[model samples]
Target: MDFNKKVIALLAVALLATGSWSCKKIIDEAPLDKLDITNAYRNVADADAAVIGIYGQFLGLQKTYILQNELRADLVDVTANADPYLKQLANHTTTKDNPYVDPRPYYQVVLNCNDALKNFKLMVDDRRMSVDDYNKHYSDIGALRSWIYLQLGIQYGSIPYITEPVEKVDDIKNLSAYPRISFEELLTRLIDFTEKLPYKEVYAYPAGNPLVVTIDGSSTNKLFICKPFVLGDLYLWNNNYTKAAENYEKIMDVENNNTNINISFNAYKVGYYLSSDYTDQSVRYLRAQDESTLLVDAGWRTIFSAPNTSNVWNIEFLWGIPYNANYKPGNPMIEVCSSLYGKYLIKPSQLAIDNWNAQRQYSGIPYDARGKLSYSTTVAGPVITKLTDNIVPATNFNRAGKWGIYRAALLHLRFSEAANRDGKGKLGWALLNTGIANTFYVGTYVNGAKSPVSFDEINTMQTPYAAPYYFDARSNNDYKSPWYRNTGIRSRAGITALDISLQNNVLGLEGKLIDEGALELAFEGNRWPDLLRIARRQNNPAFLAERVYQKLLKDGDPNASAAREKLMTPANWYLPFDWK
Candidate 1:
């Protein structure tokens, strides 16, 4: 089909619509009748509209993205009310005819991005847009396109790596003209493309700009994709461990001066401690002091349920797409996961519950707070509320929620993955289990003698390779340094630190990181990709196949054996690319 023709049709519909774009926070209040194909790149305003239009089209892919990424994984399962397509996804019986397998929506967004990139360059050449503005817009769109392509490669395995705008979808179908590249090749190309971009930072919009909108009193600056995050992932996937760790450090270290240990990006941490009470239940979990009194602690749940403006929420959510009920496409997750007022098509699997239940909290609690608050067992059934907590009986039909793309926890986990591979396994493990303060030590002088010290006293001396590699978690007497504020990931969840004796080697620690990812970010659509990436990295099909097989078998699926046998072959892990 002619993709540009569809773009024109959508643009016409958008011109007549009154609602604002849902995901990107770009409010297009200006008249679009004059912004036709001919003059879409004439000036800055027109260029901005074109970019917003691309995001507008991107809003439609949220449902497919989540389903494809989650259903095929081990964390989520199809409900009785789910359609055959969803069941097919969960069962690994997906056919080419499944609507979710159709790659048109993804390619549509790619076409729009390609068109925008081409026009932005022409506008620059014609002196219609300034160099700085061109760099910002170009880099943003480039990173976005690369991200979409990355998703496509992950889901579909091999894809036509088309960079230029094409007249028709068939153009990409011709393998001779545009050869399909493997995921590894695609990663190399994406890293090279993203690395060469002029802008490497998040897109900075002017104050009060609609793009920099306020959703629930929080600025949407984090919604825009960061170049470093994309590049970091690319490098990590490509097995360039050092480069991946360096790129991730760029986001973790906001001040860019690792030597200045005091000024660190503490918000990226999962913990929320400011005092000496390491086992303080008040900051970690809610407990009953007496029959009449119940203490409240919004520890891990706050990451999902709290408003974007809340410091507790904003600190962790690095990038999320906010959905409004008044927009064209409301939050699709409500219908997919909510059992109250929408079609509960999917639910959390028993394996996920078992995994969470097997853990012990730091306070010796039976369950992890994250799993307890992630999803609850309702009278109807088990519902996934991580993304649909905003929906209630009052406004059930008109639901509004957010689709989380990247968060600080995920970033930290990915960074640890890269670091462990790069021979920093001990540091990576410390960051994941306990804070650096507890894991490392230093010598302190008392009067005239020197003695070994840990935690607070260790703060006086910097960590080994304190520049870009080390992450300090010590809170000195003053408690003023940014590094002091960060506790480890498990510390934030009120969970006990992982036993280093059980997982001391790099391979064992890599497995721990993957498990930690599932525990921290199960339903946010990273499970399958994580499993697949690691399985591919280790060249162990059993790593991914066994988890999926167990999930199906535990759920009493009849096709579990068949799916396991099929997944034994790495090629069966991806969706079939037979879109005609």
Candidate 2:
């Protein structure tokens, strides 16, 4: 069936159905046409399938979403055989006709979410869904809908806002003529809608319920499309640093919301888990035919590996989406860069490689676990190895890398960024907990006397580093300086300690946090957005241009000057779309 025709039919079903809706026990073949869409709420199974179908639509967005977020950023560059659209995006020269800019896929999801939202009330009234479940789904649908709008707003600047689905032909026609809303307004709406979701508890289908589904081995949680997480993103983009940090903390801190839910953060354990031994001479790092292990960050890699039930609810994945080859197009993200019958559409830029190297240099560290783990060790180049599926060989078309929507590490990185926004006063806490610093302090004024601040006092105040220092210093009669008052920070005894590096200064702190983000989130489709947020926060276009220039220089890009100048234009920062 043609795409538009299918959409029309689906909408018709949403609007016109009057009979009982029934679906097969199997989710993949939910018999949308066989069941009455309007009456789908008549039973628990049907209502569950309806909601699952909305997730299914979101799952289908891997290809476009990855390209839009990753390519335009400095992380990945296009290969020779890459689609022109991909190249256009990589070069920051996207035209109005770039197919990737089309808003249809997002709208399809909106339609699905709207359909579910419109009918879910009937499910609650009819006892097909519990009132609690109804509230849970209410938030779910709202988050998903807001996410689509947010993505559209981010990618294309302004877009027509459609909260309700087009259930009739006239509705479709009317929406087609709807004027575009400003990005600010779209963000406001997105935040408002997502805020309507419950932030207290995570929601999941009952274990035996047919409504339950898995993304890889990890099961689904309606709360995975979480409100706080989405709202944090909206707030982050809106430059509301304090709010963004608060919301993100709700996900990463776990202690707050995961009261009954146990979520742990194993930073070293979060990368791709490759076999301990593999002899692929073309692959870097794994050259030895023996049982040689490549640099592995198992926990970090786990985020992109085939879902493991043991780690499904792990704190590493604050919010994530798993791809099932059986359900949707097997994650196109992994295959797009492989030697195995892949388009090799995107490859990591030399700058991405340099980013890892630079961070290593800054910290005087020899090997960056993330750099070693994320980049291909084999001669296959610097493109990330984070998302490869060990179950699938590189000789095959599908590499089975799970795409993550949000990870706990990413939250930490962004929280650090959010904490550092201009005049936000979150820097002290951000610095303490980003876990990037090794030494900290406790300030004291003995007997409330103006004792001369001594180096020994500062040195003696030092404590071994720990993130989220449970206590903070308050600036008052006891502590006069911001540095003295900073949480978990006494004061550096001296900057001359060869082994004791310091980020006590604001610029140094921001630079370290940004570098940490680059190192940890290299090709995870976040580099550009990270840059954008930082640029806006600092109110400096130079942050955006200089970073792009550095990437261009590292990548040895020829149009560095042209691209740098183009990047200076705020309008060009966003892609052009053929809205008409």
Candidate 3:
């Protein structure tokens, strides 16, 4: 399958790859002495370096990073089963993993950004670099820093916004306050930085920015204003829906959006399933018939014989960045790319299938039991490889080729928190309250003949569904529970398991972070962030209100399940941040 192509692009950096003198100390030598974000600059490959340093913050990513760490729902461990991990994560069973503490990481990224900002200021102030170098790098780093802060503010509520470089030599104590700005203030700052950024041209400006300009005029265009989606997402998160749409639109709109990639869609969707030797004429067909057209990004990537969609911005995704744990590049924006907030449970969720079934019956759409697709050559197509590294002869690209980026949105993330929780929730229907008969039967019967059966011709008269009995539960129960007779669930025919109050801790609350109306970001892995940022990940006493009603001791609610026996409490929210 194309799955091999998924993890191919990410490479670990070597000491030598970090060529700069100062940076070499960081890469080749040892990790920084202080491991602090304070002493850095934006030069000497500094922006890349600082970004990488921030990557350190993500080291403890998979641990108790999320609040209410519940894995029993989808039933997967938080560590493995990558796809399942994501599916369960969306279920609100856990907090967002690997979150950067606000003020700390934001300030860290800000330090890196301020370093670059300072350098850019130096470029403009002293006229050290030429016009081309100045503008290109200026805009490139400008966008980079802007993207960092944008991430900072979005993940953490009200960050201590800092613009200027720190006076590392003088004093860091006289720094900006740790107070946060309003969401509007934060969004505005992001807009300001994003507005000034030059897109699709990561090459530093002037006739010759140092990074891209070779000594002998040869070219080495490492980082540039060229990344496709960086700017698009900036506007997207800012609630500039029109602007966001425009950015994503540019990746496809032919003349307006001159894209360079093949499967001009959010290739990350199905792109993860590509092979290493992805460059082939056959793959071109996949790009030709791209599906990235109708996307939040969209694509017809599987149209031709090509393998799958291309990672073009605006085409598939208006823009997206891979979660570069290093380079501090893996922003929350695409940390899990095609992944969801609900990580896949070691146990898969039947939710998707259930929804599909319900939809099929209601909408008359056909259903495929193999409803979910995974990235395996056996299943994901060119997404994964066979026994060994096998490259088949190139043919026309397969239109069905997918890298797994964009997709249909999720309605609900399955629940997977497997705690032996006993916190019960109580919802009672007393015989006295409804004025029903105080006497309750042993089961779904009135201790007599044919227990109030509600007849349905299909299950009885019709031969196709013929049976001695039909489930006459609901209507039958209506008759039994009524003290007034023939109305309540007293004479029911279906088995009525004992109902009990919901107790124990199983927190369940979810909301959008970047309002879905703004980003239209359907639940992939958003639930974790939602619970974390709002500090709602905790299961406290306040989260649960004890229901103390004087009800008969024996009679209980019938709808209760063992899963609900667990209560929704404050401790269930999440483990403390450093506990992981």
Candidate 4:
């Protein structure tokens, strides 16, 4: 490649990619002037840059991460225009030659975290940072490193989990002696690492302070992966339901319940109020420019738009990957899914579409609010709208938006599954109530009184009562129904729906919970893992094979029989990684 081409390639791979892990080679070859770990901690600004650089590594990983998680699942299928790379991933036939399959990028992120941890103490001892800040950095870097390892373990099964930085060629050679750690071991480490963090009850950036300052001087307050949320997710994966619930309770503000969260295009200026109940207080803190749009409800569609701005920080979202329009090669989802630029690279499977439309509450509308809001009707089929929008200008498009890591809705469903698995009937009931209906409509008035309804009250209302009470109640409070959020729909009075039934058997419950997860987290990148989790939980590969069978059948694939046979093999659960 020419110099210009090589620079462009590096920019595309290093800056544009978005996976959670990084390559060791990427770290080894990164220009010293750009990072310079030795002198990087000389001052507070230097330390800030070092930490921010680690986040940048995530920006590079976001695209790959979302694809690996979403495309490999049964819910979505690649478009006809999709490159061979994407098609291979969607078809579960990826080869070692596939450009996107490398784990080196993720290893790069781990190495970056190691370097930061290694040098941070020097800064603290030099009095450049307060002990509190030092502790925070330690926790932050530790949490980030563990998160990368968790992703690595999930994707690759086992990896050479390294904690030390590879400063020279010798370090790389020595790494060959390190043995790969099991996924269970990695999860245990994550649990321990997150528990030891400062354990702040709540995480909010200092008032008026930016969450992280970018290399170009832009700033944002998008939350990073915090302790309770990470720990809770790890616990859920570990099947420690009680422990998971305990960790989630610490940071999740259940009292302040609002499902429809609105974010501004101007992210740094937004201030989220931390509370326990959902009310006007949610909007009271939104920084308004002209006051006319002060409480202007951001469309449910806007949350996925570029410059995605979230007004309230409920326990729902654990962390978000921040994107800036000023930065080059913005969110990869937009590049692939946006109407203007996207050539429909990723398409929704017919089964996913059928599953979405099956819960129609009325004969008048063929699709639920989630179906309507999350997809666009094109001749090509239903294109994923959960992560793509056209509001941003074409020239300035692809910038601004965050990929959700772990949210309350997903966590709630996971807890519900875990509770059901362990026979914790009552706890499962409460978790189901809170988790599914955790939207903007939770704490609003009923009968003109400040009546906060339990999740069960809202979720279980019979048919003809309007999906979420009624359009009247929703319009009166400016609350969008849970249908748009994919939480669950309320059939009018006394009508039992497939999703509404609290099935008794474990398989029935797991199937329902799995469908709910697909509805709530379809394109946000958890579908494949959700499927694998359920299959593993039951110790049955048929659970997974059946889903794949459904997808292939829906696609009218002639090879469906053969594909199902191959997929039923136990070793097919997770793909083999290049490094391992």
* Number of the predicted model whose lDDT against the real structure is largest: 1
lDDT (tens digit, per residue) of candidate 4 on 1-580: 4443343233333332332223223445755434445655775555555555577676677777888877777888777788998877777777877877788778777887888887777778889877766776667777777777777776777778788777765455455467887877878877876777663433533433223323222223444566666676788789887777666645433222343343211111111232422211222213433222323233333334424233333323556664554455666777777555666788778878887676543333444445555677787666787775533555544454566676555656665676666664333433343222232244556574335455444543211221111211122233433222222212210012453245356667667778876665678888877877777667888787778778878988555666577768767656667653
Could you tell me the TM-score of candidate 3? 0.41
Error of 3 at 406 (Å): 9.2
| Per-residue lDDT value at 2 in model 4 | 44
| Tens-digit lDDT string for candidate 1 (1-580) | 2444344334423421312342122122212332224555778666666765666567567788889988999999998899988999999999989988888778767867887898899999999989987888898889989989999999999988878865443454453345789988899899889999889873335444445545434345565677788888888888888888888877776642435332233456545554322212112423422212222234455566555555656567667656655444477888788887689999999989888998887666677657766888898788988877654333655656666788888988998898888777767876787666556645565783334356546564335654457765545454444454556788777678887863358888899899988788889988988999999999999889999998999999999999999999999999988655
Give the TM-scores of the predictions, in the order they appear: 0.86, 0.74, 0.41, 0.75
- Name the 10 consecutive residues with the lowest summed lDDT in model 4: 263-272
Q: Give the better candidate number (2 or 3) by lDDT.
A: 2
What are the RMSD figures for all models against the true structure? 6.5, 9.9, 19.9, 9.6
Candidate 4: residue 418 Cα off by (Å): 3.5
Q: Highest TM-score: which candidate? A: 1
* Candidate 4 global lDDT: 0.57
Per residue, candidate 2 scores C-alpha lDDT tens digits across 1-580 of: 5443343334323211211122212222334333336655665445555665666556667678877877777777877768777777777777778888777667767766776777777777878778777876677677778877888887778778876645455455355578888888888878777776653343333453443433334455332465677778899899787788777655544433233312221221121122321101011233332224542434334345535343432434555555433322455665676644455667777777776554322223434445555656445544556655433445453334455677655665566566655343233333333222122333455684323365544443322323332222222435322122221111110001212232334555565566566666777777777777666666777777777776666767776777789988777778775643
| Each model's lDDT | 0.72, 0.55, 0.29, 0.57
> Where does candidate 1 stray beyond 4 Å?
1-36, 168-178, 202-210, 215-218, 255-265, 275-283, 288-297, 392-394, 442-456, 459-462
Model 4 lDDT at residue 251: 44
Pairwise lDDT winner, candidates 1 and 4: 1
